[model samples]
Target: MAVARHVADTVLFEGYVLYPYRASATKNRLRWQFGVLVPPSWTAVAEEHDFQRTELLMEPRRGATLALETRFLHAGRRTVQRALPDGGFETVPELRLDDRVLVPWDEGHEEQVRLTVAVDELAGPGVVVPFTRPAAETTEPVTDKAGRVVGRLVRRREEISGVLRIVTGELDGPYTTRRLSVVVENTSDWTPAEDAGRDAALSRSLVAAHTLLCLDAGRFLSLTDPPEWAGGEVARCRNLHTWPVPAGEPGTEDLVLSSPIILEDHPSIAPESPGALYDATEIDEILALRTAALTDEEKREARGTDDRAAAVIDLADSLPAEVLERLHGAVRGLREVTTSGTPRTPAPAAGMPDLGPAAPWAGAGGADGAPRPDTPWWDPGADASVDPAHDHVLVGGRPVRAGSRVVLRPRLRHTDAQDLFLDGRRALVEAVLHDVDGGVHIAVTVEDDPGADIRREQGRYLYFQPDEVDVADPGEAS
Candidate 1:
């Protein structure tokens, strides 16, 4: 099983409870989450915008001494470097508590938590409410009139939203609870200078760019089920969140942008990478790559070795020059690390596989006129096959005949190794028949057009289209 990462550090933040209530004891395995907002320092890309809306899930602690830790992430900064010049903070139950929230003084700090503390002490009254909500939001950092970095925006909300059940306890009378308006406020701070022109302009652009990017990306991804998520607007006015500029104090100004920002963590949208254009096709394995992780473009200019040159030349024709150039380079780079018998490495451990592996064989029999021997299925050499007719595998309301050709459309997948790529790539397949052999739909054999052999090629692999693919007999009506 993949290990869950537990991040810890020091950091400043702003956020609060959406709604709070006394969680009933009957709430089995009650989940506690603490989400907060932090400031953004640099862009996710140069000339490209990136916003920070950091959130953390807080678990119930045993004592009064509550320590909050957060995952401190910076686009390109090293953990050690950021810790030196500017220390970091992990989110916990420490920030605010009706002004009476206190912690042990470690040397010159009022932050660190001591050994053991009481639950009531750390979670006094409604204090634990804001500290435990799944949230992640960001505010534009304040810049000086000259466009240099200046101040930052802060937010503190004490609202709650949850359900209540008597569970065995009785209320004095009909109890009432409140829910915060879905409308969230977009806020940041700015030092109003005598010449606030640059400051004002920057602020406007920041908000406009953020709103435009979020809404535009959200809509675009919705078209094909994008892997990344941020925020969005809802149908009702409740989605209209009320926000204020930190220094502006409840008053709004230029570049005002508001919408529900849905924050999430995605492996597909690695903070250091870009989006992909094509789906699973071997024609150009460039979509899921992390360019920033590369040293430079010069290193990208790779040459095929004698062993690989043949494979390159073999696959060039259908590959298109640009595609071959990239795939060949990628394969060569991984030759040393990837073993011949072993499958590809660094595959998206989370996303559905472009091609699934065969299932273990249930039979204990073997060929060559030998006696059947009982053996474990895990043995790689074991063969597994299933009879579709008996299994009720449907095809035209009946079992499909063997060795029949049925045109079908594949789900969107980019077979290319690199993920962050531009569109118009294709995946290849060998002409075959229908059968569930080796516990897989062996009828379809996905192939890769190496692009290595083609001279001055200008072709692309297949891309997915929902309304396009159909599975019918070769002689059937169109």
Candidate 2:
């Protein structure tokens, strides 16, 4: 089960939420391929003639060689005359975004736009222009007007399109340098295809070059890999995510580069490393609505076309029956944890492998393969603490020791914790534990509650990552 949870994490690792999750995000509408070198004309800009410069963070190790593979698309453009209301003649560049680049331009000035793509490699104060096309014979030192040698112009040719490879010697390791750019410059005077013709004129121009930076396997495995003990689990988690690399030729080893790292802005990970990508509490609440029991009027509200409720209802219906049943059982267990009641652990469904050994902390069964009588799931006796002597753990960037006041910071999703452990409300950090997967978690007992024998009930402690808590100074912990 723990392994299964890691597998789920792997699947949700990349492309889970796109750059802009909502349709309202207009600024991030276009999906730009990472590190792609494309003609300036293909991009949308208020000003004319600008190249799309892609910058990526490079983590190159010391004493290791590197190989960079770049793939680009070929786009055909034509100069067309558009009549303006002011009677001025304007030559508009039209790009074929689709496969119809062979059709004659509207004004018959059709020509395959010849382009020169160049890659500049930089580290520390040094620069190397290792690749360019069409090849350059007479080369001169080129720098941005700022007098920086930046990178060499590898090649400049009239007709060149496809994958380019640049291999380099061992790079100086143990370094972090942002040359600010590993520039891929397309120096051509072609205009981007108009948006109106984009759907039909999809050509090489529409696709951007995908650059891959790979290191020698031997060197990379030894120096940069995570600790050996955790390597198999990490690989298991990553193996869940299988992104397809774009292939240039059928048998070619070089493929389009893709990354699991979320390069864009996103919320920080919860300190606890909640195994699932979603809020289980919210899912439980939605499940509690019971779509099968809704009245016609309530059904209309559940299926309302305008908002998120309809989507939630749809998702609930689409989910497997076994999943909903498991969720129901989970929520019931949670209810038992918050209350001063003894909740008997449920038996494993028929044919399902026992998860008790994989997740010793779950404490569902004892060594004899029988339910542990009267044992709280959150009890420390289930698994030995990695650091029990330390009375406090770091929470919200502050050291919050046990017995100190803390506040809940549950996620924005609809959750039962929001009501029980309201944000900004003070709570008590009773205990802290580090799980088998090396994640730190703290058990919090709410300061104010309506329950029987809260202190005596071992199940009353709620666990969360340190990030979800803050120090509740003096009076805050009433």
Candidate 3:
């Protein structure tokens, strides 16, 4: 559960704030963009949704109990006020007290609701858990060194209500698998006016909502790569907005995390990460280095923006040399390289040549088993065989080179969301390139694109692997 929670926290605060972490930044103006569950009224007038559903397949043993934890962020408005001589406070965007400065910002308050139910009980009507948090406001006085109250910070939280419903149904097959469905809906009664902006709707919404499920007995199956027997059942499982993935240890399946972000099974945080920078996609090493290079005024503004931003600034300023070095990079594993730029394996009888121990630059060392000082690995001129313009790859038993026409067929597991749009689209192959790791990639431009010629002229084309595309009209190309 602890390991799963660690990964969930990353999802919870993703994009909480972008780099620079200042309120003045243009990108930071409109926030709370991920996993937001707004009121139903706003959904009628806007594109945002009001609910998220996650369905997974589980095989439970006798007397197995399931525990569910729904977690989210409740948006709060923080207003900075300055005390007037008449014993009243006036709302201000920024307030300064001695060395500290305060700024008005929208903050997130963590909210969690938990429930446990036996697997047998889930056979009937299942379970319903309704939770609510009432509206509240608090003020903290900001004083100087003399302890004189100069201003105040008022934080207000809007009332929020939501429901978590769980149900189970036996899957039809030889297996005893059960389909578990969990729905997290925003039941907040507040209805915004037609012209009300996003800020008003977000106040009563569930930001970054996610669910964590654990079973005392039995385990959950992987929806991404389920067993052959459960493939049909897994396909039948309907998941909306969120994706369910196995959590906890690498091989363990007792815990599952249903996150709004897509993730592979058993996703773990990198140990080299110092902490959350709110921008999960960016490299921490680069962000840390960039943050540490901010000017004094920029750092001050970032610190005054939000508490989390302040913590990030402090973390960047205090990271040790050793920790920063670790953040540079990490190598998971290494593979042996043959004379040809491919993974080493037993030489075949016909095609491959037996270079023996005298192969040049073989195994990261020269023929004498010593580091080759004359030839460096990163030198591109050292390898003369890789010519993108002349290189070609075989697809559908046909040689595909530049000007070859191919149809995109992106693999489901290895593609991004944007690549789905390119599926089945006809493209003209521009080049067949190879990476430093000996992987072949086919670069192409969409045939119907208006700027295809411009992109080709600029040497900017979409790249796909050899298997991700199919040769079109082999006879015509030949």
What TM-score would every model get versus the actual structure?
0.25, 0.31, 0.73
Candidate 3 wrongly placed segments (more than 4 Å)? 335-478
C-alpha RMSD of each candidate structure in angstroms = 21.7, 17.9, 10.6
CA lDDT, candidate 2, residue 323: 60
lDDT of each: 0.22, 0.37, 0.85
- The positional error of residue 359 in candidate 1, measured at the CA in angstroms, is 18
Model 3 clash tally, residue pairs: 0
What TM-score number comes out for model 3? 0.73
Report the lDDT tens digits of candidate 1 across residue range 361-478: 2233222222232333233222233232222223446343333334444433444544323232222222112222322231321123345225113323233222223345455542
- Tens-digit per-residue lDDT, 17-136, candidate 3: 899898889888889888999988888878998889999899999999999998999999999999999989999888875444688889999999999989998886888889899999
* Cα lDDT, model 1, residue 251: 20
Off by over 4 Å in 1: 1-64, 69-119, 123-394, 405-478
Ranking by TM-score: 3, 2, 1
Which 10 successive residues of model 1 have the least lDDT summed? 10-19
Which candidate, 2 or 3, has the higher lDDT?
A: 3
Candidate 1 displacement at residue 89 in angstroms: 39
